[model samples]
Structures are given as structure tokens and as C-alpha cells.
Target: MNQWLIVPVAIPAMIAAVLVLAMRTSMTTQRAISVAATAAQLAAAIGLFVLASDGESRAYFLGHWPAPFGIVLVLDRLSATMLLLTSVVASGVVLAAIREWDTRGRHFHALFQFQLLGINGAFLTGDVFNLFVFFEVLLIASYGLMLHGGGPRRLKAGFHYVAINLIGSTVFLFAVGTIYAVTGTLNMADLAVKVPQVAAGNEALLSAGALLLFTVFAIKSAMVPLHWWLAPTYGSTSPAAAALFALMTKVGAYSIIRVYTLIFGADAGALAGIAQPWILTLAVVTLIMGTIGVLAARSLPDLICYSLIASMGTLLIAVGLASAEGLAAALYYAVQSTVTSSALFLLAGLIARGGEGRAPPLPHGTLVIGLYFLLAIASVGMPPLAGFLGKLLILDAARTSAHIAVAWSAILITSLLLILGFARFGIQTFWNRPRSDGAAVQPLPFALTAVIAGMVAALAALSVFAGPMMDNMTAMAEQLIATQGYIRAVLPPAATAGLVGG
Candidate 1:
């Protein structure tokens, strides 16, 4: 009877369907529905967070069937956190989109709601197969949003994005099939129990399964080599779309934390032996490359995109450490990066709008320049900001895990790159006298400014609450590392190998 677990996923989906009915007749009605749906989702998310804080895990079996045979939805602290973050970001992006609403706004709202549905479902689902379904839901909605205006550039980027993710989804399907074939269950909790029992002789199969799953997640998270599609895709999309994309990438990062720690702990640790070193090495490479990309970038949006890539690498490096502290840092950084990056992207949009949608040939006024400097400093991990706190945590984790050299090197090099890149952007956009064409710039909308300001305030609040936040993260990390907490929450005690009936 604990239906609260289902409300977050179902409300958005139902509202999306309702929007389709009203799409042809009343645009105002559709917009209201969209905003109301997101608000409802936000409310549900807050409620779930309160429930989760009480340390209860709620599981709902579809059709009232039990465990392995039936699909399940599970809610825990991590899922609740993700749902809350997703709702807040989605609501912000939706509200921001209202400033630029077009005739297609109905479709846009529908897609946004559906996308949230996918994201929430992915976080809540107890079945791996359902995760794939939810991922596809997210992708399909994203495809529409990415190409919503249907420009040549967006279409081109959308093509590449969709094609690459489709392939990733195919591989995901194969991995699911393999896991099911070997373990005979797609429920994550069931597989968490069954997978380790895979015959020793068939360890190779399980490893391959794990690796395939890792690859799918890697591409989703935009880890180094698999990150080719991100910069362009984000750069081409609208700021609202880009903000949503920022949250989407974290879903993959969340999966890495959730699945690797919960379901494939021993396998992940073993894979870490082979994979962790390479991930660390590539994390350094990605950090340097992304920083360099930012420095050399011609536009603010591109700079933000590349910065995001670099941040993702940093989080992955934390994940590679496979320690409780490392995981906590990664989680902390994931939340921090999402808020900061999205805010920066919105700032870039505001900048472009101020310049009349064209890049200024030279810098503007000193006041504008000063604001740019502050934002740039914050993005580059200046002290007392959220980024600084996150980077410090990551560096501490890496050092404690004995990756001292890699840790220090990554911190130093990335800091230098960020500073240099932002310096260049600040100089170009603000320091020098504006070109003849740089007449008085228009002010950005109050709503947009308010949203960005709210994000910055939230980040500051997070810093102030760091003590309690880190405590929760540390406890969650301990629970994850122990694994038994998750295992017992998801599966019943009697369930075991080979074809256990639900």
C-alpha cells in the first residue's frame, strides 16, 4: 500500500499523456499541465526524500506479484536523492523554457515530462530490464527535444547522438540477455544474489556481461574516449535542453555508483584491478584535454561543454578508487557539477542574448566583466565555492587511496587549465573595449537571472551544510560498501540460485 514510491514515476507520465490530448486545442492548458506535472513531481520527490530519511526502503511489485518473476520498483536513499535532484533541475529548465515558448511548446513539454518519467523510473526500478526501458524512454524524449526546432545543426547533432545511443542500447540489451541467460533473472536484487553464484568455470561470461554493462554506462556518463558526442551535442542544443542533458549524464554516473557497488561488488573490484588504472590514467588525460579544449574554445557555450567533460572525468576518477571515501566524493561532486554546470550554461545563454545572439568581437563594460570573473572563478574551483569543496574531497579520496601522484597532478593541471581557459574567456568577453557593433546589450529576463541566482545560492547552501551532507554521504557510502544493506532491502532471504520462483 506504500504507493508513494510509484507517484514520482507515474504522475509525470500521466500528465504527459494528458498534454497530448490538449495539444491541439489549447496551448495555455498544455503549458499549465506541464508546469503542474513537474510541480507535482517535485512534491512527490520531496515526500519521498522525507520518507527515505526515516531509513525505510519501499518496494512495490507490479501486478502484486512477488520478487524475481515480477517487475519491482524500489526506493532507497540514493534513489530519493536522485529523484529530488532530477525534479528540481527539470522544473528549473521547464520554467526557463517558458521565456521562449513557441507553438511546439506543447510537444516540448510532453517530451520534458516523459524524459523525467524515464529518469525517475530508471532510479526507482528494481529490474535491470526496466532500466533499459527507462533509458530508451529518456533517449526517445531527448531525441524530440534535441531536434525540436529542427535546424540543420541540431538535426546533425541529433543524428549522431541518437545513433550512438541506439548502439549503446543494443549492447545494453545484449548484456541483459547474457545476464539473464546465466543468472535466470533480470531483477537487480535477484541478480545481485544469483550472479556471484555463476559457475566458476563460467566466470568469463559474467565478466563479459559486466564489461558490456560498464561500456554502456561509460558512454552514457561520457567518460574520456566515449565522450566524443557530448561537447557538440550540448553546444548545439538550447540552454534548456543542455541543462536537462547535464542531469542526464549524471544518471549514468549514478548507475556506476549504484550497480557497481550494489550488484557487482566483487566483480567490480576485480574489474577495477584491470580497469581502474586505465580509468585513472584516462581521467588525467580527459582532465587535461578538456581543460585544453576550454582554453582553445572560441565561444562560452563550447567552453562550458568542455568543462563539463572534464568534470565528468574527475567524478569517474573518484569512482575508480573504489573506496568508500572515493564513492562519497564522486557522489558529492556529481551533485555539485550538475548544479554548477547547468548554471554556467544558463549564464552563457544570457551572455549570448546580451550580445544579440552574436559573439562580441571585443570585451564589454567593467561591471559585466566583473560578474564574468566571479562566475569563471567559481567554475574553476576557486576557494569557498562548491567546486572547491568537491575537488578537495576528490583529492583527499585519491590521496588516501594511495593515488597521491595522480591526485595531485590531476588537481594541479586541471586547476591551471580552468584558470587559463576562463581568463581567456573573461578577457575576450569583458576586459577589452567592445567592437563598433557592440552597442548597448539587452538585459536578460528576471526569471532566468533568478534561476541562475537560485542555483548559486543552493550551491552555497550546500557548502554550509557540508558537515551533515558529508555525514549522510559517508553513511550511504558505508552502506554501499557493505552491500548487505542493499541486498536485504531488494531481495527476500529465502531467494537463491537458478530459477527461484517469485
Candidate 2:
């Protein structure tokens, strides 16, 4: 049962390799294999979630190798939640891709599976080095997926995306090297024990390395100053690709929460709260910028991308609080944003149909308009949707913070701005603009529409289940704050003594 921890990463890798070997075969075969593999992964993820949700953490050391010396995969509530989220979104994206996007180019199924492999690996790995390795794997897969449909727009965006991430990766390597030099271990649990014990002379060096590592996550999370690459990169990609890319940002958020709380929490002596001020300021700025971008967006895709930035901003605000309440809210909001953003991206594609400006009204214009409205409400945090509850929780979590007023003001104003922006978009696209003349419009495929509707239903269900979900999130947050569980799960008892330089 413990070995099943690796199944999420392993199954996709095996499927991707098989797909590559049979590359010459029909896409039907590839699609069948890819979908089946993802389904199995989702099941595995669900199982992991159930096991970990009880406030217990589990770790698997590969080949029975000792902890810190061999690769280890740890599944706590946080990782399990992330894995489940990835699999759910991947499942939806895969269904949408099958509706024509899969055949647009060669190796779509293979790349997609590899992308999942990387994402799952990132979520499960218990070591800094393998985390970086998984980042590269997912990124390499994304570069291909981003250019799947192939156009000057996509090529240009992909170039910028690759270039920016390459820089981030280089910085990540340097940060890892610095930490390894300081602590003599790359295992996160060991780092938790060792980081605080770093000699006084190395304090500044440790802090700098940790900050540099966070800079990488900041870029990935699209935090204000480092966020420019997101809009263009996500905006120009194929809708299916963009929809799947939704979880990519959360990967950064997850890494930030996981590492910061585990390795640099209040226990980390001098490093404690070092990142708090910067993260809070960045989160505020990100919220403001994302709202402005949404208001200024000229296309549905751009709106969705900017909305993603804003959602990240909201998620980060909770993260900045650095408390159990805040982390719980952050986890809840993380799920809401991931699902909402992915749904909107997928819907934006069907509505836009790859054209510019606004998506022209198809024959089923009313239904499309309705779907847009539902997603827009969810995105803007209006009532009866998960977004509203998420915002409320974040605000409540930050009630004692010095910047509570500012957080509330930003969230409220941004919500209104988002509502107005999406309203204008709907009016222009559905009411004001005439249909494109001399163009043939095909009704969206049942599978495609079904996928979108399914996501909307999921959002509704998230609202319905918010109570129990938040309970789980609260439990998860508590487990995270008590880092001893994670540490014990990853490091052997005798080896643990070495955490303090003994």
C-alpha cells in the first residue's frame, strides 16, 4: 500500500513511454491509453487523499533506501489534495482535447501524459533536488503542449515562456546549490531540522538562498513584479493547453506553502517571517494588477489569464497570513481558483473558436452566454459560488492582521471590477457585436460542452461541500503547522539526530 504512493507518477510515465513507442499508431489508440492512464491516476490520487485526509502523513522511500539518502515520496493532506486537483483538471482537459485538439499535432497524448507525470511528481517528491527535476520535466512537457496548435502567436508566446522559465530554472539551481552547501542535505524534512541550526556565520547566506528559491516560486506564482510572462504565455496557447496550465500556478503556490511552512516556519530561528512582508506586499500588488488587467482585457482568453493572476493574488493573501486559519482558507481558495480558471479557459476557447477580440455568438449563443455568466460569477466571487466563500474565509483569516482593511478593500473592489469587466465582455460578445459574416460556425461538440458544464457543476458542488471541505482544509493546515509529522515521516529516527549537527 505504501508503494502506491508512487503510482501517480509511475503510471503516467509508463503510459507516456508506451505512447511514444507506438507513435505511428492511430490517435484513437493514443487517446484511449492516455485517458485510461489518467483515470487510473485519478483513482490513485483519490485513494491517497482519503488516506492522508485523516490528518496523518505518509512517506515512501524508494527501493527501501534510507531516508535522506534515496528518493522519497511523501503524501500528506496538502500533497494529496494537490494530486487530486491535478488529476481532476487533467481528466477534464483530456476530455476536451479529444474533441479535435488531440489530432492537431503529433504526440499530443504523449506530451499530455508526461505533463501529468511531471505535475504528480512535483506534488509527491520529498526532496528539493527531485522537486527541481520535476519542475524541468513538467516545463519541458509544457513547452511542447503550448505550441501544440502552432501559430506565430503561439510560437512567440512559447518562446517568451521558455526563456523566462529557463531563467527561473537557473536561479532555482543556484538556490538549491546554496542550500546544499549550507546544510549538507537536500531533503526538505532534514532541511526543516537543519536550517535553523545553521551556524551564525551562515545565517545571511541561508536567508539569501531561501529568498532566491522563493523568487523562483514567485515567478511561477505570477506574483506582481515577476508576473509579466503569465498573460502572454497562457493567453496565446491553445485553449485546452491553457486550461491545463491552470494548475501550473498552484504548483508554485503549493511549493511556497510546503517549503516555507515546513522548512522556514517559526522554528527556523532567524529565517522566520523573513518572507512575510515581501509576500504580503506582492500579493496586494498582484491583486491590483490582475484586476486592472481584467478590466483592460480585449479578449476572452486575456480576461481568463488576468483572472488567473487575480486568483493567485487572492490565494497568496491567505498564504501571507502564515497561520493555520489562513492556510486553510488558502487551500480552499486554491482549489476554487484552479477549477474556475481551468473551466473558464476551456469555455473561452469554445466561445472564441480561435478568433480574436471577442468570441462571436454561435447559433447556441444564449447557452454560451449563460455558461459565460456562470463562470464569470464564479470567477468574480459573487454569491452562491465557491469563490465568494473563499474570499470570505481569507478575509476572516486575516481579521487580526494589520492590513485586514486593505485586504478587504482590495478583494471587494476587485470583485466589483471583475464583475463589470466580465459584464462588458458578455455584452460586447453576445449582444453588441454582430456575428462574423461569411464564416461557418459549428455547434460546440457535446463532449466539449459536457466538459464545461461538468466543471460548472463541480464548482457548485464545491460550494455545497464547502463546510466539509473547509474542515478537511483546516485539518490539513493544522498538520502543516505541526511540521513534526512531516519531518518524522520523511527522516528515520536515528538519522533525525543529525538535524541539529550532532
Q: Where does model 2 exceed 4 Å of error?
A: 354-360, 435-441, 497-502
Q: Write the per-residue lDDT of candidate 2 for residues 1-502, one digit (tens) a residue.
A: 7898999999999999999996557877888889999999999999999888778789999888988989899999999999999999999999998955887888998999999999999999999999999999999999999999899998988899999999999999999999999999999998998988899999998988999999999998999999999999999888889999999999999999989999988788888867878888899899989999999998888999999999999999899988899999999999988999999998987877745544344767777778889999999998888988999999999898777887889888998998998998888777765675637666668888889999999999999999999999999999998888888888889856544322
User: Judged by lDDT against the true structure, how good is candidate 2?
Assistant: 0.90
In candidate 2 the C-alpha lDDT for residue 290 amounts to: 97
In model 1, residue pairs whose N, Cα or C atoms come closer than 3 Å (at least 3 residues apart or on different chains), thus clashing, are none
**Candidate 1 lDDT for residue 419:** 89
TM-score for candidate 1: 0.92
Cα deviation at 102, candidate 1, in Å, is 5.2
**Candidate 2 residue pairs in clash (backbone atoms < 3 Å):** none
Q: Estimate each model's TM-score.
A: 0.92, 0.97
Best candidate per TM-score, number?
A: 2
How many clashes in each structure?
0, 0
